[model samples]
Target: MKKDLNGKITRGTQRTLDAFFDAMTALLQTKPFADISVNELCERAGYPRATFYNYFEDRDDLLTYCWIALSQRADSADLASVESSRRVDVALDAMADLLESNTAMLHAVLAHNPPDGPLFASLHRFIEHNARQLMLTCVDRDRFDLPADLIADHYANTLLLVLDWAYLRGHTLTRAQLHDYVHTLLRGVE
Candidate 1:
């Protein structure tokens, strides 16, 4: 949603955005994005194809927007505030919560195609960015054998794999289990 002179989203625009994401989420559950046509999306959302184009550059743009709508960035834990031992937990749990909350979207976006698509890369960057931020804020760099960036990448990629597994498992996994697994992975799982 773009801001006007006042930089605020009108309720009408907000509702349209909501309908678009909701429609995408529902469609993602049934088919791969490659197979879903724009017409299908517009039909599901009860919007005209012209309206879809007006709001999104293309299907990929719509997919990216759907993910953003699912998760917000500012919710990242203040590493300066959370305990060091718990800082990792806080960040990982917040991510796990986001995964659980957006299970269908995550699945749709990360479907077993190549992991090299623009949107997939964007998803990777999103995870790595959050991991890198938390690692820099909470880690004692002097204690690590590798660079923080490397460590964060390891953690982020592993977490993505775990999230994919959880999604495939029908989300039967508990959040507590997710916490333990990611903690081990974050610690480099030696």
Candidate 2:
């Protein structure tokens, strides 16, 4: 969402954006991402095509916006200020809670988007990027022989791989199990 001169989205603009987000989410439950069209989104939102263009370039852009908005809502904590050793636990807890709350949406997306599909790939990349960012900030490179980037990427890959298996592949593990698995796996690294 574009901000005004003060770098803040106006209440009205935020409302409009939320309309589109809600529309996209509602559509996703029944329609595949690829099958959804701009017209459909606008109609669902009761907005015109011109109005959508004012905030987004296309459906793909809107999808990105939706994920980002969802992620932001999930990440309500200041993880950056958290103790390094606890950051992963806290981050995973937040994400697990988010996924648990949005299981229906997740299942809908997974049903349409195969592991190698564009939508899945986009989500995977976004998650990996987030994991890498957090790892880079929280990791103490001096504690490991590997370079920081490699360590960060490793941590991110581990996170993404585990999450994909647990949630994306229809597995039914509880959040507590996920935390235990990740903690046990990362004990050496931590």
TM-score of each: 0.71, 0.88
Give the Cα lDDT of each candidate: 0.69, 0.80
Looking at candidate 1, what is the lDDT of residue 27? 77
lDDT of 1 by residue, 78-184 (tens): 77688766766677677777776666656665564335655456666666666676666666566678776776666666767666556544556777877777767
Kindly state the number of residue pairs that clash in model 2. Answer: 0
Task: Give me the runs in candidate 2 sitting further than 4 Å from their true place.
Answer: 1-6
Per-residue accuracy of model 2 over 67-131 as CA lDDT, tens digit each: 88888778546766887777777878777777778988788766766767878888888888987
lDDT at residue 168 of model 2 (Cα atoms): 82
Q: List candidate 1 stretches off by more than 4 Å.
A: 1-7, 73-75, 102-138, 142-145, 169-172
Model 2 pairs whose backbones collide: none
